[model samples]
Structure formats: structure tokens, C-alpha cells
Target: MSVDLETVKRVARLARIAVTTEDAERMTGELNAILGFVEQLDEVDVSGVDPMTSVIPMVMRKRQDAVTDGNKAADIVANAPAAEENFFLVPKVIE
Candidate 1:
């Protein structure tokens, strides 16, 4: 895939990057090189390869999903500057 100067400029605009004409020209070549490398990688044969999250094999540690602080609503509401009925009260903004 060939990246043109206009495409690079458009990408810079979309990314909110302040790019000069020289920088855009340089980026055009660099982006084209990266896309060409990806195209080359797409040509590689991986018919029987399994998808993996990481190169090293490891298992994730599991934890119990029991609640540790379920009955602390009064303690939590005590710290609030403006709380009522175990709930924090805020000024209504919407009409």
C-alpha cells in the first residue's frame, strides 16, 4: 500500500498533529514502508498456527468474588460533606 503526501497530511489533520510539508513528505515514505512490511507479513503461511495472547505459557490467578465491605454505607456516608438517607446529596443542575 502506497501512502501519498495528501493522505499523510489528512492523517496528520485527523490526529491533530501540527505537521509541516517536509514532515508530511517524510511521513509519506515512512508510512508506505510500514504498510509494505505489513503486506510482506500477510504473505507468510500460518495455516496451522494457534492464536496466543503471549509467547510464554502462564495461568491467571483466580480470586473469590465475595463482598468484603457490604455493610459500610453509614461509615462511607459519614465522610460526605452533604449526605442524606445514606446517599450523597448534590445540587440539581438540570431543569
Candidate 2:
């Protein structure tokens, strides 16, 4: 799981990152350690374990679906730079 300097340089290039020689050497060691930990995780056994969303289970809250316009047209159009016929006016861009 050792990452060489060349591999690190290639990774940096692929990621569009500029790296100095010193930083490349440091990153190679850090990346190798991370890969080693991932390799170690591969040795663990977790057969038949069910995936879980959370440790504690609870029902989600539900609400009734109601549709109604809460009249706020005056408040909404108050800050417009230009408004006509109760609607914001803008420069026409399409023919």
C-alpha cells in the first residue's frame, strides 16, 4: 500500500492540483497510510449485518396537504424597481 512519488504526481495532475516536490513527498506518505487503513478494513467480517439508517427507530411526522394563497401580493411588489398591473416589469429580451 505504498504510494510512490510518481503515483502522487500523477494523482495531483489528474486532480488539477499543483504540488511542490516537498509537498508531493509528504502527500505520498499520507495517501499510503490511508490506503493501508482501507486494506485493513477489508480483513473484517460483517456477514448478515443489515444496513441501518439510524441507531434509534422512530416514525416520521406527517401533516395534511392544504393549498391556499395567503395574500401577500402588496408586500411582495413593494420593493420592485418597476411594477405595472400588479406585476414586476422587466426589459423584454425575446422577439
Per-residue C-alpha lDDT of model 1 across residues 32-53, encoded as one tens digit per residue: 9999999999999999998776
Model 1: residue 25 alpha-carbon error in angstroms: 0.7
- Stretches of candidate 1 above 4 Å error? 62-95
Q: Which 10 successive residues of model 2 have the least lDDT summed?
A: 66-75
Which residue pairs show collisions in model 1?
Answer: none
- Candidate 2 backbone collisions, by pair: none
lDDT to native, each model = 0.91, 0.88
Q: For this target, which candidate reaches the highest lDDT against the unseen true structure?
A: 1
Candidate 1 residue 51 C-alpha distance from true site, Å: 1.3
TM-score of 2: 0.56
